[model samples]
Every structure is written in C-alpha cells, then in structure tokens.
Target: MDGPRTLVVSGASRGIGRHVAMRAQAAGWRVIGLARQTDAGAPFEMRACDVADSAAVRETFRALRGEPRLHGLVNAAGIASMNLLLATPPETMRRLVEVNLLGTMYCCAEMGRLLARRRGGRIVNFSTIAVALGLRGEAAYVAAKSGVEGFSRAFAREMADFAVTVNTIAPGPVETDLIRHVPKGQIDAIVARQVVPRMAEAEDVWQLVAFLLGDAAAMMSGQVLHVGGA
Candidate 1:
C-alpha cells in the first residue's frame, strides 16, 4: 500500500480496544473504531455499531467501504462473566457467545470482505487465557473465546489466498473493568499459574498487537500467541 494505512478496531469505547485505537492513531494509521456506543473524546473516528449484531456490522462496513488503504482489523470487542457451568443461566451463555464469539465472526466477515477486495490485510482477534487454562467458573467465557481461537485458525487458512492473515491473542487477566466483577482471589489464582506469575499489563498485550498489525508480521498467521506465559 502506497498511501496512509487505515485500520478498523472494534470495542473501541474502552479497555484494550480503546488503547489499540489510540496507539494506532498515534502511530499514523487512519483509525476507525466500532462499538455499541461512541466515545466523545476518542481521537479516531468512532462508529456506533454493536458487533454482535450481524446486520449492524454489515451496515457499518458498508459505510466505510470507500476508505482508502484499508489495511487491518482488530477485534477486541468482548464480554466475560464468571459462573459455574451448572449455575450459569441460559441467557448468560447466549450473551457470552453473542458478544465474544459471534461478535468477532460478524466483524471478521465484514472486514474480511473489505480486506479480500484489497487483496491483503491483517486480522487480530482477542481470546482469553481462561480457555487454555481450563479455568472453572468461566465455562461460558472459555467456550466463547475457544471459538475465537478455532475460528481464527480456519479463517486464516481460507483468507491466505487473498494475503489476509488471521491470528489471535490470548492474554491472561488484566486489571480492566472486564475483571472488575471477578473475585480477587480467583484472579490471583489465575495469575499464579502463569510463568510470569503476575496479572498482565495493558502494555504487554499491546506490544504484541502492534507487531501483529505491522509489516514484520506479514508471515505470521493462524497463530495463537499467549501473553503472561500461561
């Protein structure tokens, strides 16, 4: 691509998505953000579109079809809740799948089309260490994230012909609002299992994200890189 690169980041209203959007903009990429609600102070353009809604994702991407140099997508829009499998309500599991799994799929489908049209792009989807750790009390969350990992690998293979690389980041617990409701003891236990033995910092994950979105990672696809050394 000869012109300025553009990237779309989902879940940009807060947490990891917000950080990625801000940092990517600072790095000179034209950033477009998507979330259910818009952030007034966001430095990049923020679009209100819930990724879990397939129709909303289609419309959002349609609106951005004219963007030049569209180069990447970062799917960081996700939700998590802790509950034992038996105790978890049907609605909770459905919601988890909706936002965490289906959300990623919907965005990837829309962005995948755009990237395929351009003949190349990178897609980074977020997962969780819970899936790898087989953590109890988070069966639904783990299942949803597991789907993300599996889907990314398959999607990567399919998109390879178009030079579109798909990869995943599965980070251990971070002190984001996503974990605010989780018990401190449980969080500590999860951290203790990591070789690094500490809760992840936002920067730790962002560094990997920056690389995956950069030119150096062009050959890296269908990979699940875990942070915190879990």
Candidate 2:
C-alpha cells in the first residue's frame, strides 16, 4: 500500500520474474532479485541464490535482516516437466517437486515470517494453468503447481490477521525458456485453444503480479488467479 517499498522476487534472472522485478523498480519500488545466476539488467539489488537450498535461503534472509523491511514477495522460481506418468523418471519427478513445490514453500515460509513481523505484506506465487486444464504429459508439473496453490491458500489463511496477503497466479502458456523444450505442435495447440489466439507474454503476467503487490489488490487474498488468456 505504500508508495515506495521493498520486494523480494525469486527467479528474477528471466521470464515472468525478470519482468516483475524490472517493472516493480520502474514503479518506484526497491526490488531484490533472487536466483542462481546474476542478472545484468536487474533494476535493483541481485542476490544469487538457489531457492531449493534451505540453508542458503535462510542465510540469505538473515543477511537481509538489517536492510529495509520487505513489502512483497514473489515466488516465481519453477521447473517444468512433461512426460507420460509411467515413462517419467522418478528422479525427475522428485527434482520437479524439489524446485517447484519445495522451493516455493521455503521462500514463502521465510518471507512470510519476516513479513508478518512488519504486520503487512503481500506474496504472489506462480502456479500453472495446466493444473486447472489438466494437460496430458504434465502430470508431474501439474501436481507440483497444485501443491503451490494449496500452500498459498493455507498460508494466506494463516497470515491474514497480520495483513499479509498470499495468492497464486496460474499462467497459461507464456513465452519463456521453460517452454523451449515443449514440442512445437503442443505449443501451437495450446495457443490455438486460447481465446486470444496467441501465447501469453511475460509482461502480461507481470502486470497481474504488480497489481497483486500493489495497494489496489489489498482486499484480495488466498486466490488462484488464472491468466489463461481464455
């Protein structure tokens, strides 16, 4: 709700996370980007962090304790998986959960604790429309994203009294590196199914994230907003 605030955005090296961090800075918010790689174009401070690493994440937050209090958190780090359930390697599925589900949970827990101390903050988590649309060959991804959704809702409930809002953004088909490995035919089919008749852009999703983190969305919480372009 404040005019200028600090926001911690995960996966800010690229894709929707990158756009959100850049846009937030442009809007006068101080942005902190967390990723495994440094981003040359990041508008604010950049911290190379692997969200999947619990110890590293804890240390990162501890190091930031003396800085300005965080006003928002965006959990945008994620991994994609697409394969027949029977053919999908068990290890691959485990990794997917580790990165997508567990990573988000870790960030939320740490960030939520800090935000609660401030008595007000916002959290925007990344989910997937695949969880709602039930795309084939995406059982693992869908499951992980679904876990994110559930976690966001429950976390929202637990943090509401503190004025910390938590919500999930379920994006459809966004043009990002994560989708590069997806078959072209499948990508085309997904686009064809959209009412917009084109892939969702990272900027498009970033707008929603900005809104959620802004004062205009203060009344909302525990919602799974679907940016399916449908």
Candidate 3:
C-alpha cells in the first residue's frame, strides 16, 4: 500500500486554511499545519511559523527536511483589511501586503524548490474574487490577492517541467472570520453578483483542491479557478 501523501498548509489555525487542513487530513493526507500558535492536542502535527517572516519559513522547512517528502503546499496564510484606498491606514496596507503577498512568496520559494527537486507535487494559493470584480472598500486586500493570482500563474509555468502544478483559487467570501469585519449588506451585495448567489462553503473549495492535488490535474496548471460562481 502507498504511504500517505504529505501536505503543508499555512495559516491552518483558523478560517479557510484551517478548514482545508482538517478536510485534507480526513482524506488521508499526513498534514503539517503552520500557524502563529502551536496549540496542544491538535488533530494533525502542527508547527508554529510566521509565513510573513522569510527566515522563519526557511528554518521551519529546513527542520522538515528529515520528514516525509512534501507532496503539496497550500499557501492559505493571509490577512485582509476592508477600506477605501484613502481611508485605509498605511499600517493596515503594509500588513496586508506583508502577510498575504510576501508570506505566500516565502512559502512558495522554499516549498517550490523542494518539490522541484523531487519533480512532482501540487501548490494551491488562495486568492479572492475581488481581483476580478474590483470590489470597493477592499483596495489593499484586492491588490494583495492580485499579486497571489499573478504569481501562481507564472510559477506554474516554471514548475510545469517538474510536474508541480501551481494553481490559484479565487473564492468569493466564505462564512469565515476572514470576512467577519465586513458589513452584512456588503457581503449580501457581493453574493448577489455570484451566479449561485450564496456564500462558499469549505466543502465547495475542497472539491476543487482534491482534484488539483490528485492525478486528474496533471495537465492543468497556471490556472485561476473561481468558485465565486460569477
């Protein structure tokens, strides 16, 4: 029998990232979860690492060099602030860029290199539908996720030869703390624009993830899939 494939999901402590890690583990992947805190008695093996800190990410992956080969990485670690370009604080903008964009870059660099060496793996980077819709009051958040979308496409090309498919998922707002700060009216408006007119469930996203990480997605790379139903 084949051993369980290993997956690393950053920001696994909460929100969509946590959902992804939990579901993946249930599906038989040996999951290593990364977050700011290492809580006691988590279901999967958890590691504390700040994705925004490149050095920390590097060292964390270095420690994992002795573990099972990493077959997948989910760059789900991100932060967001909803505000107009003028009203948004500089500090909030900086944090959004740092955690959402820079953090994804750091993990991809470290994990991408490792997967390239092995010549096979999968990478899924979280993006937001705001990039396509240009949602108001989310200038910083949209910009940051835009960077993720762009990076995933180019990275996919670079990794294609190694059979490491890189893809980005741009999901509309889900019922997670990630959007808890947004006004209910705002979320309803966004949902109305979707063809399905509803919030995304974790399962909806995971169905896509399962295919991306499986053998079926070998020919699919450099793609941005929208679960937004727009």
Candidate 4:
C-alpha cells in the first residue's frame, strides 16, 4: 500500500528546475516543487520554500512527510554571479555559497532522511562547467559549485548502505535565465571549447536527469556528469 512515486524539485519557479518538474510530472511522477516564488501555472504542486534557508527546508520536508513513496530529490536551486574574486562583495560571495552549496546540502540532508527510511532513492544535484573550465569571471560561483561536486561524492558513499544514490550534473552554458546576464562572448568562448559546441537546452539536461533517476543508473553514484561536453 505505497503511495504515488514522488519527487521534490527545488527552484521550480522557473529555469531548469521548472523544466525538470514539468518533465517528471508528464512522466507520471508526483512532483512537489519548492521555490521562494511559487508558480501558479506550474503543472505540479508548488510550495513556497527557499532551500537556502535551512529552517524553511526542514519545515517544508516535515510538511511532506505524508508522501509515503518519496522516490527522488533534484536540488536544482542555485544562483550565480560573474565577477572577479576581488570585485565580488563579501555578501555576494556568501550568497553564492549559501544558495549554490549550502542550500543544496540542506535539501539533501532533509530528503536523504526520508529516502533512507524508505530504503532507496535518488538525488541529483547541480554543479557547473565553470568549475571544470576555471571560467575566469566567476570565481565565487565556480568555487561554490566545486563544493557541490565534492559534497556529492562524499554523500554518495554515506548513503550507499541505504540504497540511495547521489549524483551531480554539470551543465555548460545552458539556455536559461541563469546565464542570460552573462556576457555573450564569455558563453561563446565556453561553448567553443566544448566537444559539442552548443549551449545546452533544458531538455538536454532533463534527459540525463531522467537517466540518473531511472533503474538504469542504479549503479551510478557520486558521479558528476558534464553535459554540453565541457
């Protein structure tokens, strides 16, 4: 008598998070979306929660404890700023690390508990190609995402005994609002270095996410998959 298979997606108000929620819903999974700004028109259930706020994330999951079959979590919520290390303000750097790294860690901690109790689940966090390519203008952002990659690797090992798998996806120059403010030349340069010289669409990332959440990826954990060939 298990309930419906469910997924909790953060940053679902827009961008890649919204796309993942939509695709998961269309595929028949029950999706609960978390964001500071809730989307009224989203296909799945939307809740107001900022993953960066540890208390908010905890209360949100406490509210969702009724979902008996929580199958996965996708921590796609993140923020970025393209500024040199010295030029970046302390507040800005802190926000980047808080949202991009700590926020992800918070959600994983809460959801990891639920999934562990269920004895199996999936976790897909987001990193960035900037971390791999050492993109010059985004020092704070790159450092934050690099932390995500490292954290996922360690988390996967800790969660292994419970049959829970943790993985990360690093996308390059995705066509989303996250990159709209970045300079065109910067994006172009990054794309040109990719094996596939094109900005990734949200769908491109979603396909890999779908793989990681499926039975096919049961053996894949603690891996950072780079899309757009970065």
Ranked by TM-score from best down, the candidates are 4, 1, 3, 2
What's each prediction's TM-score? 0.97, 0.94, 0.97, 0.98
Off by over 4 Å in 1: 1-3
Instruction: Please identify model 2 stretches exceeding 4 Å from their true place.
Output: 1-3
TM-score of 4: 0.98
The models' CA-based lDDT, in order, is 0.92, 0.87, 0.90, 0.94
Among all windows of 10 consecutive residues in model 3, the one with the lowest summed lDDT is 61-70
Instruction: Please write out the lDDT profile of model 2 over residues 1-230, one tens digit for every residue.
Output: 44468899999998888888888888888889999998776668899899989988888777766556578999998889789888999999998998999999989888878888889999999998788778889999888999999999999999998999999998888989889899889988877766667778888898899899988998999999988654
Per-residue lDDT of 25-113 in model 3, one digit per residue for the tens? 99999999999898667788899999989999999987777656679999889888888999988899988999999999899989988
- Model 4, position 179: C-alpha lDDT score: 87
lDDT of 3: 0.90
In model 1, the number of clashes is 0
Which numbered prediction scores highest in lDDT against the true structure?
4
